[model samples]
Target: MTAGPDRPLVVLVHGAWHRPSTWDAARSALAALGYETRVVALPSAGRDPAPTASMYDDAAVIRKELDQVDGPAVVVAHSYAGIPTSEGLTGATNVAHLIYLAAYLLDDGESMYSRHGMDVPADTTGLFPLMGSPGEALYHDVPRDVAARAVEDLVDQSLLSFTGTVTRAAWHDIPSTYVVCDDDRTIPPALQETMAAHATATRRWPGGHSPFLADPQRFAALVDDIIRSR
Candidate 1:
């Protein structure tokens, strides 16, 4: 879909261990709705050899993308992307709304590891291992072949991305919505609810973690509704 001036551009932010290409389907769907979309490639993901960029670095990348936009934009952050998205969108006037899709909605000084009930590593220079079966955990509702490909494309995430804390919580200043994926295996539904308290509103969706992969068109429609309503 071509760029349109009628609506805000949608910016998609991917989670840890995933590439910006993961938003391809979601972007296409949003484009069909006459919305232009941009995907942010985090410096913390898909790094060479050992991962070095932290979530703060990822936040800078996101902020740079937002700074280049000529008009308003809405950020749709998925999973770990929420951490940087929260920090990055701070003081970003062009971002009109934030959508946390089965993603974390943490406050200032909160790290991903600490929110997950895990201890922050003293040494964050190393790579954080991908835990459990990502295919089942992240894409259980997606097709077998697509999920397999997604798992194959996964990379080592930086330890600091998870251990690092956000200095600013954009959701507090920006109107935000949180979508809780009930069947999510990666981030439990109960925990999602707990974090969602900081959002302007909360919604529950019946699916696993990666709903965009499960149903791109529907996901895009939901995003459209949220953006338009704001």
Candidate 2:
């Protein structure tokens, strides 16, 4: 689906411990569909002198990007980035739609940590060892083989990012879509189902947490359809 002369922009936001490169496949697909796409990289999960790109800080960056775009834009947030995107686009005028991909969708004034504390299974805590110092807690959960191949791609995230509270709920106003990965090991499939129940439309795929990397073509098509419908 294509928009008018003022085509809507598609802003892709990567979650914690991930860089914008995570969405490389989706970015190419979206670009082929004639939509302007931009993938914003957040602070890594482990940086020596970590930048001030907390989840909230990342939201500010997204807000700035939204401001520069004309017409409505679709903001897609994956995993941890969902919290910030939800808060960032609350009153954002340029955002017409919001998409959450195996991501947390918190209510106003809620933080990812608090939400995770409530929703995550108790048995999943031991999945990764805690590292870093105060104010910078980072965990690694990918399988050893996967991590070995992709660990270099992971970035350090600020503990402050997860602790930051979202002051507003963007989905309350914008049309929203949730893509649930049924085989997601990082985030329990049950949790994804619960979150998808709250979205306007839900699409399910058989894959792990990184569906954009595993199956970008289908994922991109789903996003394109949403844009066309709007």
Tell me how far the alpha carbon of residue 19 in candidate 1 is from the true structure, in angstroms, after superposition: 0.2
Global local distance difference test of model 2: 0.71
Q: What's the number of clashes in each of the models?
A: 0, 7
Q: How far off is residue 72 in model 1, in Å?
A: 1.1
Leading candidate by lDDT: 1
What is the clash tally of candidate 2? 7
Lowest summed lDDT window (length 10), candidate 1: 1-10
Angstrom error of the Cα, residue 223, model 1: value is 0.4
Give the per-residue lDDT of model 1 (tens digit) for 1-230.
22234588888999989998888888899889888888999988885524678888899999999898876788999999999999988988888889999998889878887787788776778788897888888999998888888888898787878877888899878899999999999999999999898999887889999989889899999998887677
Give the Cα-based TM-score of candidate 2 against the true structure. Answer: 0.80
What ranges in model 1 sit over 4 Å off?
Answer: 1-6, 47-50
Tens digits of lDDT, candidate 2, 199-220: 8888876766776665567778
